[model samples]
Target: MEFFNNHTKLFTAAALLFIGLTIFVCIVPALKNQSENAPLPNAIALSDEAILGKAVYISNGCVACHTQQVRNVDMDKVWGSRPSIAADYAANYRTDFWRNTATVMGTERTGPDLTAIGQRQPSAEWHLPHLFNPRIVVKESVMPAYPWLFEITNKVKKGDVVVNVPVEFLHGQKGKVIATADALHLLAYLQSLKQTKLPEGIPEPNFLYKKSGDIGEKTAGGPKELDGKVLYITHCQTCHQSNGEGLKGAFPSLKGSKIVLDENAELFVNVIMNGYSGRVAEGYGVMPAVGTNSNLKPEEVAAIMNHEKTNWGNSAKKVTTEQVKKWMDAVKK
Candidate 1:
């Protein structure tokens, strides 16, 4: 009994030490994080109305549907941005905001992340309609409308204000006006979601390229010499990339491309000068008209086209100035 009594104080001290260390490891870093990045929340400070909308978001169980964080690997690859850092959670970490009180750092992502919501859809008119009735904007969205939130917001009796109501607003069955403050504050919060900065330490993907064909097309009937590499690097490498892989859905691949191999080399020259944008199996979404640049001379466009066709295993006939000029005339017509 005397030995047990003697060791009780030592055991108590050890227990207290463990508790203190645990608290320091978890809470102290969170506190330091709050101090270091607290201003980020203020970057999109919640106004009184925004605070109310937040409450509405909470009350409507939106947290059950949407998530705020974007995980690193998944987000960076496809979303063009990275996940949230300590800076993103500075406000919730420090103060007793709705997130802190409800402990609602939601898990499910029934909808896309709200972290980059601002950049995803920047138009204020679009947001107004989406909130009133999501289906009007997204044909398949299953979210319910908050028609009760609507109230006649503006009244100008002297002169009828030409208010442009968005098509989505017409979804409210009862022709009721909306609370502008609610909509505006929601927009402010959404606008704050634009974070285009990519993740640290990750590099953007690159495009592809192919080799040039035989060079005996000149009158010499021998390998003709042209600084095709220098010409292409200077003029076309920026968008097409040296390897010719092309940006997703944007740029077309020139490596082993059918267009480069076409016997109708005149069509190739014309496109280089004028640019064609109907469609290619693999291409960037749109093709800008080369002549539209106004600065590229017809000869320069021809040189770039010749360089691409010759270098890319596409042993088609070389492009001539006459072919380029003819295509230019056709484009003007």
Candidate 2:
């Protein structure tokens, strides 16, 4: 009895110490890991204007509606790629104690997730219009317009003292002007959509076509030529004719679509895999889903995209499998 009573206090003190250490081990790492695994902000290679735009994004409560993280649930599958990790965030993020980074990511999904949005839509012009008036790009968009982002000025570059307007705003009438900061910063942030590698392997989204000089002589028995023709006829012919004359009013004529003719060919592959729907031309309906075509292989898509450009009146730039693979990579925002 004497021994037990005398040691009771000492034993209790040791017990408490053990419990505290156990709790620290469990909790401290979790908190540290959260930030360690946090994604880096995929900031774009910003210019003076884009840097200022980043300030705008932080000031406005845009993060309230949009989330920068892509969870591993069904959402990632729907959007492509998997949930982001701390390494994915890279050096783009601005850090702080509260970690306001993506804390405001609401669960409502009122707007599309902004995780890899820059990869989905890389056009600066499109983003500018969409921000000024979401209705221009997304007719169904319920988002309010940021008219304050617009600014009007006669400021002209020293080189060519002609065009006062650097870009056309979405809702701006002839006289009104919008701030370009929103466009630049938002684009910088959007362009930061580069994620890690695919789980399986790197996807092939060949944006460029190869030439004989680029890859030596063409293969003899390879399906390069025939496969290209077949895929285009089977899939593309519905919208773009066998002769490459896309339907006049409905489909865009591929005869000279900048996307098709660009020397950088992977753009076509990304458009195909992602399935473009925006108004590349005015009044056109959303593009149909095509990457889901079971019969179409990544190689075949690359071939057709190349053949279409070079065939008919189009120039023949040989596309390789490698180029398509690169385009399939998570686009660097």
Candidate 3:
């Protein structure tokens, strides 16, 4: 009681108690957890470019909109194959004394979870323009554009990586768009954000949830007529506009495209199936392997073909799933 009456002694005692509690409750537990969650021997380190890109991501405040974590819930299945675990972030460490930040693990998700964005949207073709203007790809997207990371030039200059921007999105800029080195680095970082495969015994995605069924499921009467508009919006519309008129130099217009109007569907099928890289259209960036990446089914491919052909004044006959399957089989052979 006498000791408590002395304000100085009481203050000293309280400070000691708080310090001891902090050490035991916070510091000790954190140290023990760090030891337990040590990075796996095979954990990959970020490349110099990727590290720079990570800094760009942090500086740009991307964490404010997107979350790096995938929670352990059925709804989060769309974000990643499995819920994130402590070991997943084990490799995230301080590169040096000055830079101690790692593993952003954002709280809010104004945009989608980016934990598996590398696997989900890996194409530089898609990412570049999307970064420039999210509305270019996702019309409904509210993500602010990062146009400063790119430049408009009349001449592409050899070796310069050009971004495919539709004329409408260019805001009257009469020139080709090129991504800056910082943009490339940021893209590399985004592509490197694939979820690390967890060790065995971790909870995997619950496949029981039938939110949207399989990519392409058939009904009794052949494959159900998939909503071509919906499919296009989900996959193709980002590069090619809803009107079938693609961005001027970035993506080729599907409306008057020879490929879309061709009598034989081989070219269309092959482009969708394997992907087109050669100079099919002059001055256009490479088209990522959407069919392979998205694992689009035969019926789904047929539906897209039919939609593109018929819409935008194309007036071409609808393609059947059997036709797409035959072409796919021939390609495999």
Better of 2 and 3 by lDDT: 3
Q: What is the lDDT of residue 162 in candidate 3?
A: 85
For each candidate in turn, the TM-score is 0.45, 0.47, 0.74
Q: Per-residue lDDT for 1 in model 1?
A: 61
Task: Please provide, for model 3 over 7-77, each residue's C-alpha lDDT reduced to its tens digit, 9 standing for 90 to 100.
Answer: 99999999999999999999899789889997755556778888899988988999999999988775676
Give the lDDT of residue 140 in candidate 3: 85
The local distance difference test score of each candidate is 0.55, 0.57, 0.81
Better of 1 and 2 by TM-score: 2
Query: How do the residues 1-333 of candidate 2 rate in per-residue lDDT, one tens digit apiece?
Result: 665677887698789999998779976875677667644333344455545555577677676676666675642433435555555543454435665453334455667676655454454545555566665545457888775666544553343212122234323445434445455566676555444454355352322232332212356875334457766764566456566765443456788778888878666776777667667566443454455422245576676787787887877466777777777664312
Ranking by TM-score: 3, 2, 1
Point out where model 3 deviates above 4 Å: 3-44, 70-87, 95-100, 136-139, 150-181, 195-204, 212-224, 258-270, 322-333
Cα lDDT tens digits, model 1, 1-333, are 664577887788789999999889987986676677644423555556656556666766778877776566532222224455555555443225444532345798787556655544454444555576665445567777665544544453443222234444565533434545555666565655544343456463332232355222354764444456765664455345676654333456788788777766656655655566556543233343434332344555566677777775655567775676666666652
TM-score of 2: 0.47
lDDT score at residue 283, model 1, on the 0-100 scale: 29
Candidate 2: residue 18 Cα off by (Å) = 19
In model 3, what is the error at residue 230, expressed in angstroms? 1.2
